[model samples]
Target: MRNIFTKLCVAATIGAAALVAAPAAHAVGVTAADTHPEQATFTTAPAGEVSIQAAGDGTPAGAIQWYKNHLGSTGWQGLCEKAAENSYGVTGVWASANAHWNGASPKHTTGTPPAGSFVYWNISAYGHVGIADGSGGFYATSVGGAIGHGSSVSYFNNYRGWTPAAVPHQ
Candidate 1:
């Protein structure tokens, strides 16, 4: 009985030591490829504005192209509006419902903004905006602590919605 107890104590000590030496688990960041449009809940834009499903280029390849070119860039810290303006060539890309670009009013929606669309969030007085990668993810400033790609619109607070790529209205 004495020998068996000694062995059991030794085993328990080894197990405890292993547990203490184990490394802590870290959180994995979500990528654009990991998201799906079907997983999102749809919502309509506010009154007088166009619906994301109703106007603009449903697929703004340019946005994606721009995102790819600027991926991992940290130059866009507080320039979320400027980034959107430069990428889409639209002015007054504010955080409110009045945000418009090049005479085109933005359509809004929650969850899974279409690729190349402008994703907006109400994080500040001016608001935050990023370009969607169409894979249920977005590219924006301060993402992952810098200008980069984020896996969801929910990455920021107060998700206002998204607008299709602005096209010059006739």
Candidate 2:
């Protein structure tokens, strides 16, 4: 027991030192005024075709990766409240729990969606929304389910329209 305690202390000391020596990599898609204190850091912009340099956030390529990330997460299902929060403060319900957008709203579009577009739906009372994977497919979260992916047919079936966001990323 004594030896194990000593080893644990040594490991903790080394971990702390490593953290202190390492540079802080800031979270993407987060702005000061819009930031959630205890939530996550994200950016809402066109950071190339990949987020984190991989397809970039808010891009078609990035949406695919984001879809995968969401699918792999647990307890992140539903929380429709955080849909926009997860999209770096874009591409989801704006000031309301509805799948609607306007010309003045960020990431608003109509007709067919291009790859990496923000997808919206008007299903039932409130709607659902997600990001386009740029492959005639989209990824969205259900009211109480984890992120899911499907064909464009599924998207258009409930489509209110699409919105292409080309704003500045933080």
Candidate 3:
């Protein structure tokens, strides 16, 4: 038993090192172009404008800001409005899927960023935001606010699979 544990520890160290050396890029089933129709005109919301809400108010700006604020604070600086244009196609899709949050898309319990995982991407029309709780069911916060805003960390996905995105900071 001790030997097995020792081997597992060594393997874990190597796995962690590999992840650090060659971080895995965020890849979902959907493509960036297919996800956001207005990807060309999208951008990150302003800092002061960003807010956390508990529902979708239709206004893109509010929801965008809320998501950015809640998605944790790591590698989420210098976020611009136009950043979502070509930067985060799937990011926008994920936000949209979450907006509905009706078990529409595909989601998994075994694969997710983690509870405090931070994902870097520009949500279409909304702008850049991070991942709060990465799991089968997670919740995101932004400035414009949305259906799941102001909630005590709701699951982003309800078993619906995750969409594709360029998650720079996974």
Give me candidate 3's TM-score against the actual structure: 0.22
TM-score (all chains, Cα) for each model: 0.54, 0.50, 0.22
TM-score of 1: 0.54
List the candidate numbers ranked by TM-score, top first. Answer: 1, 2, 3
Question: How many pairs of residues collide in model 2?
Answer: 16
Residues 64-140, candidate 3: write the lDDT tens digits. Answer: 43344434322222232212211222233334323422222233323554433233333343333333333322233
**Backbone clash count for every predicted candidate, in the order shown:** 1, 16, 38
Order by lDDT, highest first: 1, 2, 3
Model 3 poorest ten-residue lDDT run: 147-156
**CA lDDT of each prediction against the hidden true structure:** 0.56, 0.47, 0.33
Model 3 lDDT, full chain set: 0.33
Residue 153 CA error for candidate 1 (Å)? 0.8
Model 1 local distance difference test score: 0.56
